[model samples]
Target chain A: MPGDVNLWPKLTGGEVIDLLASLHGRLDRARKAELLERFDLDPTKRTRTCSKGNRHKVALVAALAGDVELLVLDEPTSGLDPLMELTFQQCITEAASGIANLVVTPPTLEELFVHHYDGAPARAGAASTSGGAR
Target chain B: MTTLTRSRESGPHAAPSSSTALTGTRRLLRFGLRRDRVRIPAWALSIGGLIAYFGAAIPAVYPDAAAMQTRAEIVRDPSGAFMTGPGYGLDDYTPGVMIANEVLGMIAVAVALMSILLVVRHTRAEEEAGRVDLVRAGAVGRRAPLTAALVLLLVANLAIAAVLLAAVLLAALLVNDLALPDSAAIAAGAAVVGLVLGSLAAVTAQLSEHARTASGTAGGLLGLAYVLRGVGDAAQPGGSTLSWMSPIGWAQQTRAFVDLRWWPLLVGVGVAALLLTASFGLVGHRDVGAGLLPARRGRPAASRDCSAPRV
Candidate 1:
């Protein structure tokens, strides 16, 4: 799936698959297979006009399936189920460990710092620009 | 995250799959045609029927050649000339020619306005609705949608021309016992004028940001063209040069059914092509949904005109 909704009019599923393949290589193939298995998106069907959540899945899959240098997620967990949220968190952590800078904005500080930091979570009302680990 | 690391290690850029790319233009044209099918035909039929009905009525009011001449004399009277055009041609009037000359300018205006609205609705409207942006992202070039919209308009105009020609000839034959060839030629000439005006409107639509502004601009230009042609037709010698400035004038100069100078129609076709080309060029230089002219920003707060001061 293309990241931008503006790109929807231009892209067919095949074109999207090709683009994903270009960005992520063999992983794109596996990713596509996984998506087809999970989401049941039939290639033969006309490109479906998806809801925001479905669109988000496309973006999430594209992001998680690729070896990107910088992952900047603005509320990435939105519209994801608990299972999918955990899957997304795992993907982010794995990427972060692999030298990719993961900058994710969660709705709550507890969620942002959970299990990642040894210290207390950053205060909710605090204005901190230092990118400090809580 | 793992994927990003892998991609970085592998290479930043990878080869894309060699799938066939769809032409954005073909798809857009199909979509546009579907959208305008009812609207365009309705416009063409309504306008053409109106012209045919009026054309048929013309011969009844001025029943003979002498009556036609008297009507011409009345038209050429200084006061009438001020309202219409120069009266010198009244002596040469036929019912067919009189009808052609009287209504051609206004018909051209109507045709042009129709063309402008159709093109603007297809192009700028799509852009405003975010459809163009979506289509462009897929393998479509910047010019494809614009080109497709123009092509659709051209097809619509041609259909309009055909309908108009048939209606005009049928009315002329039934009402005035006019020669078939002459009636056909006059109808064709009127169609040519309409196409030219429509092309002008199409170009103007591309130049303006909003549909309303584009329509207004095209309408204004058409009005100007009519006035120029009208004054030129009324005046003598070099004054008629103003008519030459307008596409409407080109149609009138055809003198359809009177002398039927067919060559002047070439001018309309040539101008239409030129204007359409200009529109294409303009489309290339601007972003979709934006016009060559910038939209004016208004004040953040309401003004006195917007909000009446209550007691």
Candidate 2:
């Protein structure tokens, strides 16, 4: 079950191991291992109901391991720590090298450049009205 | 150790092997079952209970064969027959047959609804939530999840059938006077109808883009089936030929407790299989999160009609 206990019993452990092995290149196994070790999660314990961050980690690891041509990530780093968030961006940038990476997010990340449109008519009206009054 | 280093090291990797898709389907089905455990069982129980309740109530309402005849006469009338079914003028009109005439269509509708909800929840709902993209990026194929969902629906339908059979038998035994074969036949007839509608829903779920649309399509078909069955049964009292067109008609034609034609059940099974195969064929052709007929795209920006100023 590739550490996901919720996977169906019909799928054998060998099949999951094969999938993980294929995705090995995209994700850093050492980092995932480190997180698991730091959290003191049993290697044998399957992930039943994980938190949002944990689910993100699982998804990120899975995504990295495969040849995902287009990673349509929607608010992928919303719930991550600063360090993890930085790591996520780096991973995304790296993954984007040979593929099209489309990441959609709200206007909250400071790292993203914003382009606000100024209303020309409103500005012109204000200037003309002020000048006429003066 | 970092993601940057990993990406730098492993750029432009090969796709996973084909086997990963099968594994993904299994995983998805397991997850679906876990999510819908409570919902599916509740639906099955409610349908089974309704069947059992009707089975027990009918005999008490019309105790003797003469009373059963009077009730059949009312049902045999053009209006009553059109609304319900052809009043099979069995000399000994048993309560089991009476209940079958009254409730089989309703139970079939319930089964159809459950099938629609289950299929759509697994397919379109997952796609809308963006889960399909994640799963698709893996070894999963476009059709595997849909296949798994259909299989799950099949299992659920079979479970409902078994429960209905058990409930009907229990009701007959409790009532004391009703014959056992008659009760079994009635339950079997209803189960056959439920199976057909359930398979129909499975097929419809794959054809429509959204869950609601899929449900509406399946519900419309079910309603049509019932109306056709009622009309055909009413128009030709004892003839079974016209009844074959409608799944509900096929079920009622079983005439459990009266004549007990067990063979008509095979027609229901055949139709269910045909629909299930059609669903599979549709799944094979369509992309994940998409239907044979794609969802129409709306205007990119909000329309003036949507954001209009108040009067």
Candidate 3:
């Protein structure tokens, strides 16, 4: 990557991850491997061919790898699944514990205030007076 | 040493505040090259191959001085001159100059197109795709993408020049008195035109948010340059300064084998430098993915369109 600027239209998952690591300017080999393994990303697949979840992971890994003071993330986990979202949050938490200065937008109420798994809206006040309606 | 290790080992990553914005230019360039691996080779091979063919074919067509004179006369007619621009070295009727006369104009246009496409693809296209901001988020300078694009273009042009030289030289039997100097000049003229148009696109890339519009704008300028020079070459009594008005005109004045004048090349190089500098300034001051000329809002109310089906 000493020369070409990859908009990375065709770069594979591994290549993209490596580029992210390089851009961060540290731990080239080890960090790329670790990020890919940690995210469960397939190294051989091109970014375009990746699923939305994989794409989100790519960005997440890239952000985590950058050697920057401030990271302004806007819905960084927009398209990810719950499991990957958890992993992303864990990674960010770990990454933030030491160096990065994060100015993150809090998670939307739709994600945090609503839990669809129980088939009920997670409202603190409505829980006790819940009524069955058609 | 202690601090370096601490920064490296202490966190996910570390940023030394003093590191320059252009820290990742080389990476961007290499990535760009990978993306263009196929397109660049295809363009270069076809153009180079055709130039080689022209170098061989033109001399064969005019084996004798008499034949060369007849061809020269044909090229002089205003209609005939329009396409090729007032045939330089027609009076001398030498094969080397004739090779140039027939090829340089078309080659100049091709070179210009190649440059325009490259700049737009690397700069505006990337911005349009929203990938530019992703790269910019890192240690890249505001001008690094543009710089990388131009630098890559230089390599592409050099490759073209090399391929052209090889092609011409291989066909170099001095058949119609084709000489090394003439062939090299033809290649140089083509190469110089490429640099001119490359810089033109660099400037244009900053003018439009949409890649299509940027490409169109650059293409339009190339068309204008060609027309201005073509008309000037044909209409002027004898090599008018009208040709001086456009970049292509400056290139043609190199006169390849006939005069081998190198001074006109300065015009193109100087203009290209100025344009490149302006582009860097424009990019540095403006927001990514937004052009200097902001897009205008459409009509607030929509007109009924009963005639067309909506998608």
Candidate 4:
């Protein structure tokens, strides 16, 4: 899974995006163009020349840009800035209709204090950040 | 409780693109071609270049019918048949036919090897690398990749055929003996042999999950074909009943310069079509990244090889 990010490093970003977008649904050409612009990734640049974050964008665009039934993400927002993370989160929310999103993340301090948990499925001790239960 | 959505062959996400199992074949083929820009060309050129070299060199070395006759006798032995072709037109004493007799068998094997490697590289190799999984998870259909790989190979083989035809014709003309029909038949033989091997490769790719295993399976069959055809041609001089069994043997039956038999080429096309249909069937039932033969589980812990070597 991790290794495929660098697959076909010579392919242009646009080509990679096109291939990935076709995997999920046949969104119109304009929608794909919008997605690429939103990510601020250069479509003509070879993948080998793209930055790490942009490479992530390529994979992220492939995954989230399509009309897929389920979006399963693990550490999807690790490298994005605060604004892009929110944009990423908003994209998921927009697809919330009949779509299942499984987002796996470590427990945060804000969640521990802001929310009340009375018999939550996960035991409280499993929330330790040093070694997350997940 | 609701489960995460899995898109079916027919689903809300389905469009004209993902409507069937082969919906994304063209896209996958394009993607495959982009990835293999250098690879396919190199293989095709090598085969074509060899054909050209043989076509040009044969006439230069054997200047007259008497020299050609001597060359024919030398290649009529069992070892000669095994190395070259069935020696069908070796006795004909013409440079055009002699080239076919001297070079076609080896050329057939070369093209077959080319097609086999190309198929396995695109199919099982992609699966082994885990790239196809990502492609599969998208709106792509199950059979698209296999179909695309075969299609790419078919195009490549045809291109090579055209190149060889041109090469042989030019060589025949340069030697002041223009045999267009003979050259065309030999070029067709090379092209169809590739198609046959490409089909066999598709079948082999489904037999094992690993690309190497798939390659080995297909390569073994190619070797067996070569041996059988060689033996058959040696045993039966004009054409052997034994050669009927091997794909290579059938190619020899094309009799490129001797008689230009088109029936064997048709049989090759038929066999290729049959194998391709079977591949589509086998692919539909197997899981992604797996072969028809189930993968065996490994030991819970590493065995002797897993331990560190002694200091």
Candidate 5:
């Protein structure tokens, strides 16, 4: 989900949601309706006539309605009101609770240091040495 | 509402399995068309209306041979040649010839503009607005958007052609009898011009991340072509090298009612095909929401007037 969701201005909020969900290979109508109600978005209204917060809600409903394994939201609440923000928090928390087998694997120290360090020392004339080292 | 979970033929991440660049093109086409329902009709009708009006009105304005000859003389002047075409069929000056020579250029310009706007609106404009990022996040393929845009261009241009053909046929029956092949050529010429420019706009869309820049580049090219056509026709009898250089000129050289040539239109088709190939190749080289052309970098530091307390 993008921070500022840009949609087809000519399409109603409902149509946009359906279009996105359909593209993702599914359309859970019940889930979509619930999300629309929770977000308080009028699905009949075209996106061009929507306010910034309303547009964000339209994207929110579409993303939430999808049955994806991961939901990556960037600044999801930037445009929402306080009440809507609370609703968003509740929804995300509830959804996260549904993940039963979450796992984490740590990278090896050598691998981590080699790939993650951005400020590593820049050594000169190491091009020929790297082949020998490997 | 009843819950309906309709699974597509493939899974969510079906793009890899299919190994096709144009997956989800049909859906995108439907979506694009729905979005432009009002826009397509408006453009089609206006251009078609102009053709119909001119086709019918021109004959009425010059009903007889003498009147048409006089009108043809005026059209043969330097100003007319510059604004119109190579002054085809001026000796005979029939209604069909008048419309083809004088009105086709103006109609072609409108069609080209329509094509450019349609392609840009779906491709670059959507990408610039961040809408494309969201769309691509789905099961949609990389080339689906561009394909959809081009398809929409085809649909819109076809609509114009249908209207144009009907108008020509109607005008022939009621106002002036025109050659069937000439009418068909006129319709074909206009639609082909639209396709040529639309494809050019598609290539331009890939060159820039900004919608305005992409549309502007395509429009600037169109303007240049129109100017070249004007200058080339004005200076020469059958059009000089400058006219041949433009897509607009290629369409005009069809000489629909006068000479009724079909070979000139092939130039537009070949150019459009080459441009389409280039644009599709460009898409794979760039990331979503990024352009082939590099964007200008901003200043590293703010000026003294941009202090935090200034707020």
Candidate 6:
């Protein structure tokens, strides 16, 4: 996932989430539901009508709700508000302990460093300490 | 520890050689069809409805042999020849021949437009919007989206053919009393045109960076085809060599209700196959979100407005 992403505008948020997650092999429905709730995204709303933050949440949920081998997120939370940004951090933190390898580019790394590492590691050193990475 | 243990239990993930390049085509095709369910039916019915409407109406307009001959004379005129077919079967013109001559040009144009729009919508539009990147990053294969799009088009065109066949057959049963085989030829001819034009869209999608450009290129070609055929048909009533230059002309040369030639359609099929092959080749060579045609290069330096510091 990148900073600016797009899903089919004609599809509802839930349908977009489901389609992308299934394409990744298997969708974690429970995770999808929980993420949808956490992000306050209206699953029934078509993506074209969604705000930028809401659209980011849709892409975020689709990427994070699948049990894939690797998650590469670049500027993934650019459109998110403070609240949803925290929700995103929480989801990624939980995902770090799972089997998948997580690689997130800065400034997400800067945000995560402040929140996750008790402000110990420098910005350059932070992501490696966070989780599994190749 | 539990997550690490579970990861170990699953062992090393092997390279994805197990899955072929076309692995997710069927799923993508299914989803593509589901996405366009409403759209496909609307295109099919409206185009077929035109055939049905005209099929019933043409008989009323020319009720007897004398009346049919009168209509045929007008059709044989240069303006009518420009608008319609190569003036096929105008001498013996039945209601069936009228539909084939007068109506098939309109039908072919409509079908070609539908096919081009549909193919570009699914293929290049998806890629341009960056939605394709999202899907491609998943378990999907490299070729799947393009394959799925072409396959969906094939299914859609087939459905259009079936609807057209029924529309013509039903009209025949009720009023026109046209022969079954000739009516089938009408439906089949339109479907071949759809496939040929749709395949051209697939090729154009690879040529241009933007969806609008892709569709415009294909549509432009179609217009050129129409003009070429019209001019050729008008110049020589039975059709000159210029008519054969266009795909539309090839389909028209099938001469559905009069002579009902099948070889011209084979030529259409051959050209479509060549276009499809070219499209697939383009897909294999180009980077995702890029076209074979080079995009406009950007300026190296920022503009003065951008270089100025804000207060």
lDDT of 2 at B200: 76
Candidate 6 lDDT, tens digit per residue, A8-50?
8789999999988988878989989998889898999999898
lDDT for A133 (candidate 5): 19
lDDT of 6 at B106: 81
Model 3 CAPRI quality: incorrect
lDDT of 6 by residue, B43-78 (tens): 989988887777677667767799989989987998
Sort by TM-score, best first: what order? 6, 3, 5, 4, 2, 1
The digit string of per-residue lDDT tens for model 5 on A13-90 reads 999999888876678899898988888889999999999899989887887787654454655666788799779767
lDDT of 4 by residue, A52-111 (tens): 667767777777667666554434555666676666656555545345333333134443
Candidate 2, residues B1-311, lDDT tens digits: the string is 00111112343545445454355667657656766788888988898898778766766787777888887787777667777765664455666666667666677667767776777777766665555665665556557777778778777777777787787777666666456676666666665666677667667777767778877887788788877877777776753456668877877777765677778789888998998888778776665656677678789887787789668
Give the clashing pairs for model 4: A23-B138, A23-B139, A24-B139
Model 5: per-residue lDDT, tens digit, B1-311?
A: 01111112333332246736788899999988887899888987887777777766766687778998998888788787888887777888777777788877888889899999999999999999999878876778889999989989999989988887877776665555658888877777888889999999999999898999998999999999999988888887678898899888888898877777899999989999999989889988787888888888887998677755565
Interface RMSD of each: 11.2, 17.8, 17.3, 9.8, 16.9, 9.1
Off by over 4 Å in 2: A1-58, A61-75, A78-84, A87-134, B1-23, B177-184, B239-242, B297-311
Worst 10 residues of 2 chain B by lDDT: B1-10
Question: Ranking under DockQ, best-scoring first?
Answer: 6, 4, 5, 3, 1, 2
The TM-score values for the models, in the order shown, are 0.66, 0.71, 0.85, 0.80, 0.84, 0.88
**Candidate 6 — number of clashing residue pairs?**
0
Clashes per model (N, Cα, C within 3 A): 10, 4, 13, 3, 0, 0
Q: Please, what is the whole-model Cα lDDT of each candidate in the order they appear?
A: 0.63, 0.62, 0.72, 0.73, 0.78, 0.82
Tens-digit lDDT string for candidate 3 (B1-311): 00000112344544477666466789889988887888888887888787667657765776678997998898888766767765777788776666667677787889889989998999999888877767776777777888889999898888888777766665555454557776776677788889988988888889888988998998998899888877887885234766678787877787776767788878888888888888888886667778888787787766667446587
Give the DockQ (C-alpha) for candidate 2.
0.05
- Alpha-carbon deviation at B258 in model 5, angstroms: 2.4
Tens-digit per-residue lDDT, B215-275, candidate 1: 7887788788878876776675212788788777777776666666678789888988998
Give per-residue CA lDDT, model 4, range B1-311, as digits (tens).
11122222333543354278887788889877777778767876777777677667876787678988887887788777777777777757687777677677777888888889999988998888777866876757778899899999988888778877887787677676677877887788877888998899999899898999998989999899888887887886765877888887776787776778778888998999999999989988777877888667888986776686666
Q: Which run of 10 residues does model 4 chain A get worst, by summed lDDT?
A: A125-134
Worst 10 residues of 6 chain B by lDDT: B1-10
Chain A TM-score of prediction number 3:
0.67
